[model samples]
Target: MVSPVTVVKCEGPKLVPFFKATCVYFVLWLPSSSPSWFSALIKCLPIFCLWVFLLAHGVNFLVSRCGAKRIFAGLIFSALGDAFLIWQEQGYFEYGLLMFAITHILYSSAFGMKPLDLKAGVVMGLISSFLYTLLYAYLSSPFTYLVGVYTALIAFMGWRAIAGVQLCNDLWTWTKLSACIGSLLFIVSDLTLAVNKFCFPVPYSRAIIMATYYAAQMLIALSAVECRDENEYKKKIKVT
Candidate 1:
């Protein structure tokens, strides 16, 4: 049988690699980096890898610990959505949006699995509605409609999470909130892209938008790790 000391040492080794991977991914976002197709490709590489890493491990983690299958499914869909959004090929926006919508639906369902207060939903809805409306006013044509729908869906997911409050521990709560905020930043980044594509003649638009986009994806990955950690902790507690 493994002694407690041995278990602790094993845990330490696991954390070192996790932190190292995270740091490596985070450092790629520094400004002043040259813009090349290769650079852009590298920037998105971490998120794609992270998505795969988490989905493969996260499902097992959840199944053995929290038994939250829905959460696992949501994460898988969200990761796929992220992957779609990162694709740079022309005429793929609608397909990306469709995947993102599926992600929102899964996220919302996961959030709803937790018990929550009704008022949280109302508050989130109001805030999301106001923000999206203001944003939509500045966007052109069908892009505005597309973004409006996306915003509403994400807002609803966030509200559901807030209301359900499945993240019982403070750390988990923080992680969930960070992921939600990251998701919002991603939406902003995409909106910026749409503006640039359709209406704006702004300089450095790609840089600005990509900065936010990368940051958002990084934060979401961090949150996923945190959520997994929290679930693992709870499992240990239950076992003890």
Candidate 2:
């Protein structure tokens, strides 16, 4: 039998701070004020807390070592990206796009391309192509190229995240599924944001975008954690 210490390591309690911070942001911060650096920091507090939890947690296990570092970096970038977008200061849009593009690249790399799932890739490509085509006329010169690259990066990230589901067999299945769903939600959130910003105004667009974005980040972060089987986890906690 696995030792109690090992069990505790593998079956540690989840990060509660993330959820608490998320609730506080949506309830107290999202609609309170105009765009500012402070608002952005408030918006990204949950993600920042998640990053801290990953670093400080007792668990030594990880779904993937390479993935862990990449996702952590991605979280940092994501927070920076949020700050730019939320502030919406002069030239901040481009900076936001740049940060988010890097975030997607890191996420895609961490998700890995082990199975070579062409089907998922093709689907992501088709969707991104369609969206870009739709947004083409509205995009100005610099934004045209910037948005295009960002779209491609996000699509690649989504493809990798969805394709990773195939790697799941036992304990990792939930995490795989979590990532898959998270990626899809990220796409939805971005799609809504793009439409509202470039194409036309979307009613309640801010709420929709932030809602999906937060959930996507949360789930993706959770998926990176090392998961244990139910009975095994129970025993581990019992021992602890």
**Candidate closest to the true structure, highest TM-score:** 2
Per-residue lDDT of candidate 1, residues 33-88 (tens digit): 33344444454454555455455444666566332444445545544554454553
Whose lDDT is greatest here?
A: 2
Locate the minimum summed-lDDT window of 10 residues in model 1: 1-10
Clashing pairs for model 1 are 116-163
Query: Candidate 1, residue 90: CA error in Å?
Result: 2.7
What TM-score against the true fold does each predicted structure earn?
0.58, 0.86
What digit string (tens of lDDT, one per residue) describes model 2 on residues 1-240?
333455435534555678788888878755434676677778889899878767754435433476877888899999999888875646678888888899899988888887678988998899899989999999998889988988999999999988877644433366677778898999999999999888999998888998999899877886676443567756655665
Q: After superposing candidate 2, which stretches have Cα over 4 Å from the reference? A: 1-13, 30-33, 58-64, 167-172, 228-232
